[model samples]
Target: MAVSNVYYTNMRTTLQENLLQKLERLVRKAGMMDMDFENKFTAIKIHFGEPGNLAYLRPNYSKVLVDLIRSKGGRPFLTDCNTLYVGRRKNALDHLDAAYENGYNPFCTGCHMIIADGLKGTDEVLVPIDGEYVKEAKIGRALMDADIVISLTHFKGHESTGFGGALKNLGMGGGSRAGKMEMHNAGKPFVNQELCVGCGSCKKNCAHGAITIEDRKASIDVNKCVGCGRCIGACPVDAVDSMCDEANDILNKKIAEYTWAVLKDRPHFHVSLVVDVSPNCDCHSENDAAIVPNVGIFASFDPVALDMACVDAVNRQPVINGSYLAEQEHCHHDHFKDTHPDTNWETCIDHGVKLGLGNREYNLITI
Candidate 1:
């Protein structure tokens, strides 16, 4: 594997070219414009930032890409799959409302917004791939339907995967409800007996006869449970929950495989903004203070190299005083690891390399 080219530009901006202009210049210099996007349906995959999270990428940045793609005769739309967790983004209606509240309305992004997994988060296309962990990946239907995939990620620290970069955006973010269950857990969802109020919602919605209710408590039969994750979404009182017991390293590898499934046989591009540098993922409604100062924008054809560059850039920055990373023990040396001791981000990068997703060794071309 040769060194992939990862283009970068610092946060410095003159009066003439603002950050938006710099972003346009950066991606253009990185060769995104060279793709034959004419009349193609382009899916700009992004995290709209959990409702209260203020660290997400601004919709204005997306408008730059939207406008540029339109200039090339490409039809672009800002998109993200519904989250599996019980949150503002768990269903398409709630998810779109959250996106609109977070400033991702069509007027702001210069494009439409699509909840890739549809209303209930069950609309998906199963894609088979040969990998160590995942054999078949359930990807969001709208995401797979796009002619081109583009990950516009907020490069920030994540407690689960060490960091949420391109792989997290495309892999974990691309999965439908069931696909997320496969990545996050080894088995089906279990009912919290204490919280289960004899509600039959889970039982009624279960396509498989895996759920049983007795004595005002619901129980799940592992043998019959197919892990479709419908129960998790159907439980109105949030009594159902995924086991979520997958090891972080294995979770990273599965994420790599899912990303492969999304990008394989498609012309894909990546962009990561290392601005917030939060201690946890944006899935949290409340974002923590910045661990490190802001790095600039990164773009590449190689998602692996793009993540590598973003993490590398973050590692070089000095920690901010009073931030969560500053309070933690820094024996790990790497910023992400120091922030999240249990997580190993390298697993995703390595697995991506093994799956021929992209190269870890990158030439950082500063624009």
Candidate 2:
């Protein structure tokens, strides 16, 4: 396979040129402007950082892309799907609040923020891509409707995937509530009985008739439940929950397949910043100390190659003393592995390569 070009620029900045300016320069050098953006609806997929998580990329970073896109006559919007877990971002209203609280509002990003999956997490588009795992990916309706897709990722370690990079930001982040369930579990959800109010909201929303209200309690019939995750959103008390029982390796593969479904027929670009380098995902309410020193920013049309390059850059750094990585036993000789021993981040990349997402071999072009 041929090697893709991954552009890089160190975090160093001069008095005249700040980090944001450097980022603009890097993306332009990486060929972000090569695509025809005239009148296109560009979806900039990003994590607004779960409320209280301080490690996600700031809205200032996103404004760079928003401004650039608008300059090219493209309509840009920052978007992300509702989370499967019960959090501040579980619904559109709360999700918008979390985003604005994190400074991702229109005033900051120079574009509107959209909760891709609608008021409930049930609004989705079925994208069929025959992969080994996912046959039809349930992606956010707004995300699939965009003319272009761009991922603005914050590179960090993850308990499940070892590291969260471009592909994780695109695949896992792009999934609707049900899409996330399919990737993380066996396509089934269970009710949290303690939290169930038996309001019949879930029962009313379940198209499969899998939910039953028994003695003022809600229970899901797994046999009949199609795992569309509609009930999860409809439950006012947040009683519905995903099983999340899929094996780690399988989960990674499903994420890659979902990524293919998102980017298959759209013009896409990926940009990842290896800053903060948190020990766990930004999905966490709290972010740990950095595991390693800041690497830099990387961009490419090829997400697989972009991720590969970022991982390589991160592995080359010295572990930060007193950080999570420093506290762990360094048996893997890899920072991400040593940080999250149970995870094998390679599965996603290898599966992405097999899916023809991008080449694993990349030619790093430092600017």
Candidate 3:
């Protein structure tokens, strides 16, 4: 059966009048509220931007969605798994602090924040998937256990994936920290001898004892490395970095497969806010300049269709001067591909379609 995607940009009057009101209308138009929600737990997968990142989706938008879910007799909670790289969100304690600091408090979004991977980032469910890159996907237990899943993605450019849309949000954002490592890298983390200051910070911070220093430089024992990503953040000089040996196409296909694991059997809905329009993901503590002006909010039953529609919409918009994409002559092409020449965002959508996750073809209706 073919899936349908519904879209609505952010052109309404106000948050009270425009954004919030539009969310209600979009949910209805997408028929998301048509599902049975009485006394059921609905997990709203979202990225609570890392601390110092100011480009995250506004808490106001979450309130709109949360209110709508509640009105349908569903209990909704904002949730995200721990990140692969060490930061404010590598563990549940710090992760929750980062979330609350970013104004994801219940008072602000009208929903509690839950770290899906648990305190140590080990509470996970291993889902078997036959894919080129991944055999089993490590997903957060709470998300895997949810009655329904909703992804509220902040659509933007990504240095790795061309763009972080619904697929990236579900595949990368939904994984356990270890799961993210599996999807992002071909192997474990490595240390740059030049950047190591012999600070011992990496070793001390490493919970797995995967790192060791010799002659004031750090080295990673892949055998011992758990791929936890803590040493990556501990290096002051940015010496430790992710291994990019994973093929981009394989990454995209694996992402689709992982997303399938996350939402295959559950009632799933996706929404994306195309504001900020940063040239990189909100995962960065510092967001780069917007490559394009704010597009709008989008909602759909099919994540792939929604993402494809968003890329098309951005490509149609006039490129902003002085942005990262301004100098590119082919800015008229797929906006994400134009910005990231090596990445193919369509791979995710196509693979999603293949995985029975969603459809790539969509009907865009302006609201």
Candidate 4:
């Protein structure tokens, strides 16, 4: 593989050309318009910041891409699959409300917001990749149905993956509730008896008859439970939860395979904004101070190269004073490693390379 081209443009803007204009130029320079978008259904995958977390990419940024795609005759819609964790975005109705509350409605974005997975997070398409970890990946049906897939990622620190980039956004974010369970754990979900109110929500939602309520407590029969993660979402009290026991390296590898499943046989493009470099994922309700100063925006046809470039850019910046990274013992020279010692983000990139996703080597072309 050759060195992929990753286009970049700093946040600095003039009165005539603002940040949004710069983004348009960056993506165009990165060759986004090279694709044939006439009458195509384009899924612009993005994280609509988990309600209160202000670290997510603004709807203004997404509108830039949405408007551009529309100009090219593409029918664009902002999308993301429901999360495994209990939050505002765990189900479609709540997820749409969260998006709208965060100013991502069609009025603000010039496009509609669709929870890729259906109301219950079960509307998925089984794609068989036969990778080292995952065989058949369950991705949201709407995401897979798009004629073109574009990732508009908010690059930031993640506790599980070290950093959340294009692959993390597409791979993990594209997975249905069951698919997330497969990536996060090797075993079935267990009930937290203390949290269980015995509302029978889990038992009623279980299709396999693995859940039973006895003595005002719920228990899951592991032998019969298939780990679909429905009970986790169904529990009104959040009693049922994914074990999340997978090692970081294996989790990263599975994420790569899942990414492959999402982007396979599709015309895909990636754009990442390395701003408000938070210490944790946007899934958190609140965001801490940035670990580093705002870097810039990156776009590429190669998701691997795009992430590698953004990571490299972030590592070069000085750590922000009084931020989480500053307080941590900087044993590792890498900021992300110092911030999250146990996570190995390289596993995902290397796995992506092995799976013919894209080249790690990249040529950064400043716009």
Candidate 5:
């Protein structure tokens, strides 16, 4: 296996170097300063936690990167695409509201926040990947328009795909609503008539004529539906949704493929903070107790190696007393697996290697 370099630093601070200053030194040593940011439109892809989830990374850390990028003459902005599910982040207006609620405003972060997919999450650019699962990825226009992409992720356990790391953030997070449906399902969508009020918004926006209205309800014609996910964005009532039926293994593979579409041939970098250690994704409306103590901050050019190193670090830590991981049976030896037995986080890592995203093996260089 090819070995990659993953730089790490423990969550220790002193009067001389606080965590923020420590982060700057770590990234600088990891070669973030080597990138040519001059005159580049840089998109810092980050998750603005769901309104009620307090486990997301604070906006303070982002300002450090923003200042560094601007110092190098790069025009940096914080960016994320709209969500597919019904939530505060399902559209640009509401998504911005959620971000603002989480303290991600320009004044706080020294940059602007952009909902990459525009008003309804329909604004997308189709990039051909021709991978095993996804032939073409529907990425947000703003992300595709950027000259450089930097993924700043919160490393934590995920209910569906094992763990949400750099690959999840760049691949799944970079996708437009249509692209998300492709990764989460069999590239098709269904309507819940109970929530549909026959507004005909879906039917009006669908270019393929895949949706119809009857009896004050809307139904989707799967045969005619192209699975563009425009209806999911069009539905005012949030009735349209993907089946979310894709097997976790395939879901992980598709995430790797989509990650390729976002980073291939682009100037890219990744950073992940193994703090909070939440047992579930930050997408949740409410955060449960953290599963483990904070490990540290990590940086790498190889995203796969970065994720691998993070999980290893987390597994090495003793589970917190009375935490979710502590309550589970420890037979698996892996903290993430013990917490969510059905999930195999390795699928994403091995598939990432297969797709040449990065090496799963690494030399962890502690800073």
Candidate 6:
């Protein structure tokens, strides 16, 4: 395979061009709407900000793409899967509520929110893949059911994957609870005994009765546990968390394979917003300081190239003061890698290239 092409546009604008208008122009230049969408069920996979998180892509940015797709005759629906760790977005109902609270209503973005997995996060389609870490990937039924898959992602730092971009958005975001469990660990959520009030919320929400509270604390029985991960979200004190057993490199490779499962055979395109360059996943209800100034949006037919371009763009800009870089020296390059020395973000991209998902080398075309 050859290097993929990634198109970009800086956040600069003339007096006549505002950000929204610039976005429309950029998408066109990036060929975002170049596909034939006539009557197709298009899934616009996006992360609606967790209610309190201020770093998610604004609905206005999405509207640009949504309008473009609509004009091309695609039936577009904004979607994401239920999360693995417990939170407001663990179940479809709660997920939808969080989306609405964050201003992702149809009136706002001109799209509907479909939790990819069913109401309980069980709806999925198993896709077999001969790979190092994953044998089969459990993808959200809604995403798989769509005729076209488009991802609109927020580029940011992640404790696990070094950073979150188009690949992370699809691979991790496309997973059902079980699939997410497969990607993360060996199917278990542990309770932080100190944070547990023994409120029984976990016990109440565990569909498989895997959680039992005793001595004013909660414990999960691995034997009875279905690894549904519902209890993680149910714990008010945030006591429950998914176990992280796989080494960072292995986890990154699994994420790449999962992304391949989601995008393979689908008419797919990607868009990543580099604004509000937060230093962690938007999965957190709150966002931290921007590590870099707001870069513009990027789009590509290749997710690996898109991620690489975003990383390159970030490195080009000087670090923001008082943001996580304070008192840090020799921040030479590869800031995300610097932040997470254990993780090799490139491993995922290299694996992705090997899987024919996309090429790592790319031509950075400015729009």
Clashes of each: 0, 0, 2, 0, 0, 3
TM-score: the better of candidates 2 and 6 = 2
TM-score attained by model 2: 0.98
Q: Per-residue alpha-carbon lDDT of model 1 for 36-96, expressed as tens digits?
A: 8999999999999898899999999999999999999999999999888879998899999
CA-lDDT, candidates in order:
0.94, 0.93, 0.83, 0.94, 0.92, 0.86
Task: Kindly report which residue stretches of model 6 are placed more than 4 angstroms away from their true locations once superposed.
Answer: 191-240
Candidate 4's displacement at residue 315, Å, is 0.7
Q: What lDDT is obtained when candidate 5 is compared to the true structure? A: 0.92
Candidate 1 — worst ten consecutive residues by lDDT sum?
A: 229-238
- In model 5, what lDDT does residue 194 have? 81
True-structure lDDT of candidate 2: 0.93
List, residue by residue over 230-256, the lDDT tens digit for candidate 2. Answer: 888888887888999999999999999
Evaluation by TM-score, superior candidate among 4 and 5: 4
Model 3 TM-score relative to the real fold: 0.88
Q: Return the number of clashes found in candidate 6.
A: 3
Q: RMSD of candidate 6 to the true fold?
A: 2.6
State the displacement of the C-alpha of residue 1, model 1, in Å, after optimal TM-score superposition.
2.3
For model 4, the superposed segments whose C-alpha errors exceed 4 Å read none
**Cα-based lDDT at residue 272, candidate 5:** 97
Q: How close is candidate 1 to the true structure, as a TM-score?
A: 0.99
Mark the 10 consecutive residues where model 6 has the least summed lDDT: 325-334
Residue pairs clashing in model 4 are none
Q: In model 2, how large is the Cα lDDT of residue 204?
A: 92
